[model samples]
Target chain A: MSVNTTPMPPERLLQLDDVHVHFSMREGLVRAVNGVSYHVDRGEVLGIVGESGSGKSVTARAIMRLLSKNAIEAGGRIRFRPEPGKEVEISSLPRDGRQVRELRGGHIGMIFQEPMTALSPVHSIGTQIMRTVMLHRRVGKEAARARAIELLERVQLPKPTEMIERYPHQLSGGMRQRAMIALALSCDPALLIADEPTTALDVTTEAQILELLKSLQAEMGMAIVFITHNFGVVADIADRVAVMYLGRIAETGSVDDIFYQPKHPYTRALLQSIPRLGQAPVRRLKTIPGMVPDPFNAPAGCAFHPRCAYAVPGRCDTLVPEVSLFPGDQSARCHLAGELPEEAL
Target chain B: MVGYITKRALWAIPTLVFVSFISFVIIQLPPGDYITAYAAQLRHGGEYLTEAQEAAMRQQYGLNDPILVQYWRWISNILFRGDFGHSLEWNAPVSSLIWERLGLTLAISTLSMVFTWIIAIPVGVYAATRQYSLFDYLFTVFGFLGKGIPDFLLALILMWLGFTWLNMDVGGLLSPRYESAPWTFDKVLNLLSHLWIPVVVLATGGAAGLIRVMRANMLDEMGKPYVETAYAQGLSERQVVWGYPVRVALNPFISTVGWALPALFSGDVITAVVLNLPTTGPLLLQALKMQDMYLAGSFILILSVFTVVGTLVSDVLLAWSDPRIRYA
Candidate 1:
């Protein structure tokens, strides 16, 4: 194959190709991320939207190679393009080895959901942030401290200098989240994976954090894989959205394609469930009927068939739906999503 | 933080006093008095004391005083004048005898604690990280064996091994060579050489228990999201294991320090007797058997103080290390 004349090489920062993550227990194996595939471009915020148990966090953890011992990556490849120069295989990287250590905070960084428990209780904010700075960057203590203060200020923390001396427990939820963000950005990583970073915060703080992440991503030009179950958050921040259902991507498209032109029945039900502001109150809010099928005992056909309103009676129950391209350049996995009634649209 | 430690230290005084008082009452509860034991020994030797002679002896020893008054006097002397009454067995000042033995016990206990922690922490952390691997399984087996086997049996086994395999003396802190040159390097090394068997035996059970505690604590800490966060922050596996979980696991281990202190300080009475090392544990046991109230009471008081102080120190250290902890 000849080298193609493609501009910017599509700037694919991280790509998961047909990834499958499963958990083996005494009972059975749970297919957590079943054949999930997606690509995060440089400086782009890719939102993984789904309800609880949709494998959004698992997908993010798989990218970072932070899965538990029970979690078996049955099949798939996670490749991280650190910069314009080289692409590294994340799945095959030797954990606890020197090579993985070098790449961890140097090329990739991660922020967890709960800030209360994320930071070390023993260390002060300054020391924790300084540790990352000194670890990756060959900087002295004084320089790292200065950089830590600067990073704290950049994260919109109050009194960055004084706050640095205080421990994580001394800070409120928003402050701790900011400190976590500061720690993540300290090494100037090429990829930032935020796994429900604002879920534990209040609504107002969540908005501020999301906005902070967006502004920071724009300034740093780092590809971010933002994991959340909130569709409203995806609407406000995602460049592209991947909707997960029963450990598989039911739909993947541009934000508009997902929000305005949803082609998957699961995605449509999720959008309908969102409590829209200014809408008249009703006896019961719209909800996707039935719960997610247990991952361990998932159905042989489409996992969403039991709950999908647009399910084709025999086909949806017997045949596993393949991921197929829809009309508006959107990808969906459903037997009759393209043939929905006009009024339902 | 220093102020917090100081406050904790101050609070320990009252706690120690209460513990000492209870220990004193417990010691006094037994029917036979120190004078009775002395009287029985005299009778065994066929030197029967007349009623007047026994009364004079009791008066001289202040044995006729009420139990509460005697306790108050003993406590007053210890707290105010630093005098710990004369021992009925050795006829030497109880404080002096206790101090000499205490210095030796302190050295052994300190060495054992250092050795146990150095060995246990790493082993526990390893077991936790490996979970059910071969190394973890081996340590778990060893840990259970350590916990189940009696301390005295452990000492006897060590002593037998020392005598048969190593051609070593199974006894006390020093060899006969130490009497000539007390502070020489050779004496110190010789002392340590003899000191280790008992210390190792005494510390083994504690170390094993600590390893189990540390393993459980580390496993718990490892499950905490903070540990995962540390790994996600790109810290090395060593950093995550030693840095995050180890520190948090210290909390449980620190609380156990109080319980371990007296056990360590005593240096395992059976081990001391089997090895013939004249540590305070065997001496205290002998004192109890002979009903040398002053000797036993003073030793018990010292041990109580040590237990109290050791716990306080660990608590303060824990508070200092953990930012979430607050001094009340």
Candidate 2:
């Protein structure tokens, strides 16, 4: 994908080095994202699973530098490689300057959870898509319009010519989501950040959208940073999974490693919480104790200590747990990550 | 869209009839008829008209009939014969007096409305974009001050300052020399010179209110996900703002088009009186005060027509501009 004499490796597509996003609200400084780090190789699907207030979406926004005005990337950097041998430090760019703006849809397109609100209510889906194609592709209006119809067709919308002229309100919920996906894929960004994209969709529609995204990612050969709260979605779509909790990565491993052999307490708890068909004897679903800690007054030591069932008293509360490595590149941030027995976990 | 417009227009017919009835009833709700107010005025001016003369006057003006019959006569003349009855106090046909001042009133109101928008929209946008900055704070203060100051008082101060410091002829729509002059380039120029004073006075409160409205609307729209989507499209901040939020912010502006024409006549009542401008505000005020039912009723009916027409235009524009509203 490089236009240079020397080609760089595809593994370096995107790298987050100790990313810290803090919001300075009136109450206090909220560490919404405290030192998050992950990487996405070209054409790889990385699922980030977390509950509400887990900072997964915030972390994805930090990657695109699309945080609120009160928010600041307190420290660390986001290194993005749009093409081989062309590295850009996204965290250093201004929030809305030309450089960051170029990095936005031109190189790193994003889609939100609510497709209803993501597309402009007043603008036609065609105009919304055409503007992107025209801006990034530098094409004429007619050509841009043609590309918009092509995109709508590619996303499997019937009667694309009619769809192009229709506004967001005229379309069904699922159709609007598909149109949003089309708009995001307009310029073919190397990395796509989908923040709970399927959460707002019904199950059948969500499955269709997931299938569409998977096929599109394969065809386009672009990396996807798929952020969702659904573990089931992660198992079906992701090759790799990064479980986040309380603004930090609790664990990062392959789908098999996360689902079958989770190293973190939070991940284990999460997996057990998912209702299985034959687990009727345990009729009550197991829920993680307590809630995600408030950002204004977070738990000391391990951020997840307060909610961690496997947490050791003084060791977990007094000292912060560092990342513990495991076999097959699996990693977890917990004091007793490797020491716990399989039965106990 | 054409069907929608036609439907809205048809709906306004009943609205006009209902409004006309309310206006006529309310106009007559006072102690006595126009003859009573006129005779009281004559007595105050030391010209005593006996009860017999008053009764003769009432009969001549058709004011002694049943209220409904009187209403039917007044309305039928307006609808069938294009007559607005007679202004008992002014002693002239209501149509003649209204048509003469209607042009100037429309001009002033239209100009002031335009001026209000032209100034307010940009300032509101700037304030919202640079929210909480010194410029935003300054505009906040400016908006509050503008909204708080009474239009008539502002006109008075501006007039005094114009006469004393600038030495400009400040009040009235035209110079005394051109007051009775027929339509000419010079008279038009003279009218324009005095026009800005009342326009500024009338627009001040409106612009101030609209600025805050635009700012709040823009702020709300700016927070929407579509704005972020626009930014993610690699559009410049300026493009993202103007193309997305600004258009949505202006829906309220489009809705205001329905009432704008009537506000043109009614918006400057106090300020026009203070400035002594030749507009319909004072005439409406006098017609109401003197219980000149025909003149008052005609004014309200004409305003109702303008309102109905304006609302239809506004509804069409709004539906065209916002599809969500069209469906709604």
Candidate 3:
């Protein structure tokens, strides 16, 4: 309960309490997001960092109920709290029900990885954005058009009027991404889920998109769930970071804490693997050994044990580690979170 | 865009020439000329064509000239005089013979095309969106059957059904009273009454094949990220299906228009024979059977023009509908 006096602890915008996502395949069930839990506060950016199969995107899609037909939310809850004590369990709602439809693009918006393919090539940029605006808001066509042009200008796309009439194929990659961002923000959604929005872009363009996103977040005061495989990006934009491995969160903390004082071996290995600029040209980049375990039949205990440099023979191979929280609101799901050596390599 | 269209039009000229040349050469490839076949037919019918008469007929028809000379004569008439020569069997101008049947052929082919697209687009979209559903499976069964069965067989079956159940004539494009009559309301009504059977038979294969193509194209488009982006925008299922994937999927289908022209015509021929419809298909078949090179060549030339024109139209439509293709 928020005390009238205490600065009502910045409202919890969205929360996921131990969510699980499973996809049924002919071969076997893929446990994509296994007991994953995290939350984003108002105006805060939470970066979910993971490899391709690490389930980061799956978690983001789970929040939006955008998983494919074969996917099932095996367990857990995704609760969105618009205000204190007013919660809607996203996991419990029917996938195609009107409630979820209203929640998407009305209260929540998403931008995808590839800008070229994310925007429909057959439609003009203005039409796509205006449709989104009209879908969520009761507005006239002229008003929606004005809002679209405004959003395009806000995203810093040049020639807003002319560009609105042009198709996605006419724009450069960065401009296309800007247009996509404009579409996502047309409704001024409360929560924005960006699934690797800059992965397909060049570094300069990626940085520009990230900068644009940060400024937009500042301007709109909306929470962002930024999913990516790049740690450098997480360090740049995220206030809090959640490092995922094998469909579970291995470590989560403030950006500084996760980068400077990583607790899990996987997180430490990930940090060491980053190719520093000043390193010797002949030296190979340090890589964590062993592949991610097959999802159909994951290892018995710690999923990272096979790849962890400091794996214990008997204990780490058998007993799954429970999430251990540290003093500074940081947590790591590792058996020897505190006892690992300082050096990762 | 005008420049592009002009370029396309200019390109079609050479294509048509090449097609006409090939058709002429292939039609001339058989061992004997129309006179020889005519004499052989007369012999079989217990009559005789004297050698002098055959020789005179050959000379008058330019059959005694070199093959190159004959080709030049044919091509020049088409290119400079706009004349397609005379039909050896029908004893009329090839142009008039073609004109006599062009109306019905175009009507049947056009109607079949319209029927095909009208059925394929929506059903294909449905199958793609609800893949693996019972309706999709059932539709797939129909598609397979439609694709596998020959058009002539389908015509026969439909004709049998119509005669047995509906007591309808089911053959020819018009009733006896309207066969050679002017284009009046009664004739039009009679034509309409008889048109449905051949149209259904002719359209089945194309419609079924197009449904499969459309379904595949739609499935591919559905997997593209733009579709997911549309959904994420909270567009309804109907809006998303129609707006993004359908538009993108239509590219390949539109490109098929060029090929569909020739296919519809050829398919119409067999169906026409089976149903005894008064279309260019039966005329073409008869001309080929009689070794009437000009008549057969004219049919081939007309079909070629339809193909080239169809391709041009499809290209223009593709450019207009898809911005990616347009800019490229």
Clash counts for the predictions, in order: 6, 0, 0
Residues B1-328, model 3: lDDT tens digits: 6777789999999998788888888778888878887898799989999999999999998988997798889888888987898887887899887777777777888899999999999999999999999999999999999999999999899889988999988788788877678889878888888899888887788889989999999999999999888888888889999999999899998887777776656546778898887778888889888778878888888788889988998998888888777777
Model 3 C-alpha lDDT per residue in residues A227-334, reported as the tens digit of each score: 999999999999999999988999999999898889999999998889755555645668889788889998878999999889998988999898899878799999
Candidate 3: clashing pairs of residues: none
Docking class of 2: medium
Instruction: Please identify model 2 stretches exceeding 4 Å from their true place.
Output: A1-9, A277-283, B25-72, B181-189
Question: Could you give candidate 1's per-residue lDDT for residues A1-345 as a string of tens digits?
Answer: 122223225478888877888999998988888888788888888899887888999988887778899999887777877778787777788756666776777788889899999998888999988988888888999999999999999999989999899898898999899999999888889888888899999999999999999999888888888889999998888889999988889999999988878888888888877777765676666788888787778987899988877777779889888778876557988777677664332
iRMSD value for model 1: 1.2
Q: List-wise, what DockQ does each model earn?
A: 0.69, 0.74, 0.64
State which candidate has the highest TM-score.
2
- Which ten residues in a row are the worst by lDDT in model 3 chain A? A1-10
Report residue A61 deviation for candidate 3 (angstroms). Answer: 0.7
Scored by DockQ, the top model is 2
Worst 10 residues of 1 chain B by lDDT: B319-328
Which of the two, 1 or 2, has more lDDT?
Answer: 2
Cα deviation of B73, candidate 3, in Å: 6.5
In what order do the candidates fall by DockQ, top score first?
2, 1, 3
Instruction: Report model 3's TM-score to 2 decimal places.
Output: 0.89
